[model samples]
Target: MKIIIILGIFLTSIANAGEHQIPTAPQKYLDMQNPIVKMDEQLLKITSRLYKRKCSKCHGKKGDGKGYHAENIEIKPAAFSIPDYMLNRKDGQLFWIMMNGSDDTEMVSVGPGTDIGLSEQQMWELITYLRKEFTK
Candidate 1:
């Protein structure tokens, strides 16, 4: 009886191990071509500074959407790391949001000469930086 129980346990363990095997990474997917160009140091600096000055208030320091003032806002800030949320928003939509702001939330327009000021170029750069950094 003891040997039978031990053998059963051993077989179950082996079966479970085989069933729960980790999936291997696909080399073909990893080797797929992408057209994104790397940003220069100056561009990176501008992105970092812009994020610090304007975005850090609500989007957080690392763009994790947990800024200092986030708690006080009625709606929680969007998490950049979320692929579903990021995928739904297009570059044009994001640009419009940056320029015109959302009426539903605390987000406000940061267009040229506005209180939360940002030029069109700056907003576009910000959009580029965010898309590159967050999207998979």
Candidate 2:
């Protein structure tokens, strides 16, 4: 049993060894800026809940991408807690992923028209929250 567990962990590590291959956002999205300039208490409260509900299952509460569903998914969720990872990604890139999702991964569209129904402002707020709370 111990061997099995160790092997599972090893395989998981191997799976996550490579850098993520997220596509670039369009020029328009790349040029966009985050409108939310602040991370007040109220915003944190709201965005935390949003993250817990929609993201924690895969991204982990600590933004480590080893949440409940991470083991089952083919592609791992982004690990925002990694040093300099979040800082390197542009705000618009994050926003585009939240809105349109990735084609190669299971991440589905969560924009306004989708079932998740996240508005543009809400996505931006989540981006702000992620940058503030997860970036190492």
**Among all candidates shown, the one with the greatest lDDT:** 2
**TM-score (C-alpha, index-matched) for candidate 1:** 0.66
Model 2 CA deviation exceeding 4 Å by range: 1-20
Q: What does the lDDT come to for candidate 1?
A: 0.70
Instruction: Give lDDT per model, in order.
Output: 0.70, 0.90
Tell me the RMSD of model 2 versus the true structure: 6.2
Give per-residue CA lDDT, model 2, range 1-136, as digits (tens): 9999999999887877565578899989989989998978987999999999999999999999989999998778889999999989999999998888998797888989999999999999998898899999
Error of 1 at 13 (Å): 52
Clashing pairs in 2: none
RMSD of each: 14.7, 6.2
**Clashes per model (N, Cα, C within 3 A):** 0, 0
